[model samples]
Target: MENARRTTLADVARAAGTTVPTVSKVLGGRSDVSAGTRTRVMRVVAELGYRGRAGRAVPPDAGRPPFVDLVLSGIEGTWANRALSGVERAAADAGVEVVVSVTRPPDDAWLTRLLARRLRGAVLALVDTTPDQLATLAAARMPVVLLDPVRQPPGTVPSVGAANWAGGRAAAEHLLALGHRRLGVLAGQRTHLYSQARVDGFRSAVTQAGLDLADDRVVHTDWRRAPSRARAAELLRGADGPTAVFACSDAIALGVYDAAAELGLRIPQDLSVVGFDDLPEAEWATPALTTVHQPIAEMGGAALRMLLRLGTDQPPEAPREELATRLVVRGSTAAAP
Candidate 1:
């Protein structure tokens, strides 16, 4: 009775028009199935709500655990969560489970211990860890795909990152095109390669356009909400303030908005602002921020797929993927006052 009603391998086999042993092989995480058979079995398993795990090798039992484990460096903020959502969605479609963990201090020891367990592959969310930290993880011999990984080594590890430098240059050029010579840039932490690249690109654009970037015009702040607000306020209060501002991220741009409101300054009319990482909330900002849009969700999904492909000894399917970025002009930016 009740056991017969419950969905089982035999039921799935019947549903997919396959033999019991064939269904069992695919459900047991074997790669021997042809593409067509694997797809059929998975569709039936998903339809029947059959779940199996993947953290460790185990005899096939009802509802096995997930097979893939996901490692995340930082789990803070809406952006991180949204990106993880994309990865999780892809993993679920493949019948894989995802485990997310943060990489805290003493990076190597913590990472090594974490990776000692069985995992199909790993992904670093934003690559905030130090070079030494990356080297230690690479030595573990596990297939690793890094999102926004620094390009210092530029070796054969599958790296996926945004075209940040181009975005920064575009931001600067936009302000310049609007006749904004006195411009200020709100930069994120210098240690992060993404931030560094943005700063470099902005500086390069200023130089190329024959505009001077005064030392005081650029303010570097941690990618925190409060600190960016305070720093933006300090810069805005200066005697010779900028006519326009470029914030490295939307989070930092939010702080700038707060500071602007406190100072009774109007957007575009008084100061034009541009931001990076056109997050979902960017359009909803008070004046609707003008920003550089990065494909955060797509990047997450692609990184996960690349790692999964590494499960076998296949050739690199699309190594070193660099997604492009574009500038979205909106109410927040206008001709300098």
Candidate 2:
């Protein structure tokens, strides 16, 4: 009952002006105590951070090695799986454990639960962080590293990502080299930093080739396939639709394929397609997708390593590190018809 490290029922009893037995009885769901006394003790137990018999039975940090949270915006597709694998592998090598969670940004429920636990740090993948959230983590001294954050994070936070702009330019240059003057772009959410970076790079390349985005097609849509398909199909319906299209993600590229199929357009022959991320499924497509290879797993590992350094009171090698991205040529694109 004498817990020096944390609050105990004895401490709760003194604070609540009651006896330890009564506090214990209330926690145990016993009905012997008067309602008024039980209510006050229960409130004090919550305030004092005293858990019942289960919590007091063992030390909170005892026998449990430190772990980091691998928080994902959502486990949407292969990207999340690959990111998780990379972090898990790196954590395993570093003698740390990974606790994965799917959470939404600006939500305090996850923050409250996270703050209550004993975690080394957290790696947020494709998640947005608010000023308040960053302040809370800073106040709690919980280290964090952003992995391809949806938006640009504050300069103070460390972040890891692939070279999105270069990847976009590479995709654009590839299409342009293949004799395609008219190009199209299927971008993710308009506010997504990576998405916009890719689009900007793509435009820069096309402009360097004496083409203008004003004459090209650019559709900003959801990162998933269904919405992309609808948008791409509509764009393709135009008489001057692009001969080649650059999709910001592999998922969106697949949707373009669906659109092409719906419209009876042949890959590379009728319409050339290029995608980003170069996910596993890209190779198995009807005509293997020519895409930009973003080191998704490597980014996760980098974030994990950065978080570990921060947890150890060491500064990261850099505030933001972007791994190189390269274009992978395949069957999806060809010289314009």
Candidate 3:
């Protein structure tokens, strides 16, 4: 039997006839390595089976770069994935390395540690951090960017987000144009600023059209599938319920669709529905879903850029950025009964 090539660090070290630690140190890029020793060790490594870390193998770029940190919530969600991709792309273009941490509501100890370490920049993805957390972030003197609007007054910190209000208005206008006079609104969590903005915009357009928005017509939901579906089921089964529904999110709209089916109502013919957030699944739903499209990718990119700028100076600049939204008409809506 033939023996396999017995490649070992000793073999390479022997080829150079140097100490084992010298070869190991040179391969590890230890600064103590003499130039002549480094060249010899590298030559032996090329002749042997040894490989170095890829990042070390690549030559360093010549430029001054900024460091960024991204603190996101719910990394598993579809929307969060899309937003993260955008942020990564922007950070790469700026030659900044982004250190990311997943953050949750009501706890900020992790943030305090990161701040104590003195990072160059940080961004908060659409998470509900407490006012105390915001104050802590401010006191830490890190340049912070809020992903979605917070309950705090405007101009508190730089924020870049979708024009949720415009999205709401667009959704309402689409339904109204379809002759949907009697409407039902399924709102998301009231604590969420974007959700509240959407609800207010919908209500504004509905009232402007001279339609009476009865107290019963609007329902507050937690934006989860089971609860929203249960609430929608009740509304659909009622005798005087709305002929049209405007759900604040695609998740809520899905519940409405399920509820309408349980009540034996056909979309468009018997009930019209409009939704916010044109998620990928929106178009694939039965009868399709008419919805408002927010520029989710652009929102993420803008937030990253804004945070990068803020890191240079920690002054409290309330930069309010609004990305445009559009109405997408699909098969789910039609003239009201």
Identify the superior model by TM-score, candidate 1 or candidate 3.
3
Q: Candidate 2: where is the Cα deviation over 4 Å?
A: 1-63, 312-318
**Could you tell me every candidate's TM-score relative to the true structure?**
0.74, 0.80, 0.77
Candidates 1 and 3 compared: the better one by lDDT is: 1
lDDT of 3 by residue, 1-337 (tens): 9988655667778997898888766544355767666556656665564533222322224564556677777676467777777788889887787778886555444454455443566777776765434543443345678776555433567888888888888888888888888788888887888888998888889989998778777788886666899888877776777899989888799899989888988998999988887878688889899998877777888888888776333454478888898989999999888
* Predicted structure 3, TM vs. truth: 0.77
Top candidate, metric TM-score: 2
Q: For every model in order, what is the number of clashing pairs?
A: 8, 0, 0
The TM-score that candidate 2 achieves is: 0.80
Model 3 spans with C-alpha error above 4 angstroms? 1-66, 116-118
Question: Best to worst by TM-score, what's the order?
Answer: 2, 3, 1
For residues 1-337, could you state the per-residue lDDT of candidate 1 as single tens digits?
Answer: 3555566668778998999888766644455667577667666765665533233233224677545555566677767887788788888877887888776654333354444545666777765555434433332334577887744433656767889999999999999989998899899987778888888888899999988898788899988768999999988886678879899999899899999999988897988889999987789998999999988888888788878777423233438777899999989999877
